[model samples]
Target: MDLTNLSYEEGLKELESIIDSLETGELTLEESFNKFKKGVDLYKYLYEILNKVEGEIKIIMEDEEREEDFQLEG
Candidate 1:
């Protein structure tokens, strides 16, 4: 599956489904391992998206703070 094209919500939903499948103990060993790896990849993708958004938020907050400081000194 192409995780790169998934939205964060979609990736999260897929991960949850993978977890439920693993919990069922129904897959062959190879299939379980493959699903596990895919789940990990989805986790990393979601994490990267979260980190990027967090960085953007920090930058915006910093800019706002600087603007407030400048206004106070004006």
Candidate 2:
């Protein structure tokens, strides 16, 4: 599965499903391992997306603060 295109929510849901499957112990060992790998990949993708969003938010907040400072000066 290509996780790169998935939204954070979608990746989280898929990760949850993988956890449920592992907890159920219904899958063969190899299958479970494969699922685990996929889950890890999804997690990394989600993490990267979160980091990008955080940086964007910081930039927006800084911009707002600068605008406020300018207004006070004016």
In order of appearance, the predictions have TM-scores of: 0.95, 0.92
Residues 7-37 of candidate 1 have per-residue lDDT tens digits of: 9999999999999999999999999999999
RMSD of 2: 0.9
RMSD values for the candidates in order, in angstroms, are 0.7, 0.9
Q: Return the clash pairs for model 1, or none.
A: none
How far out, in Å, is residue 16 in model 1? 0.4
Off by over 4 Å in 1: none
lDDT of each: 0.96, 0.93
**Candidate 2 wrong stretches, greater than 4 Å:** none
Cα lDDT of candidate 1 equals 0.96
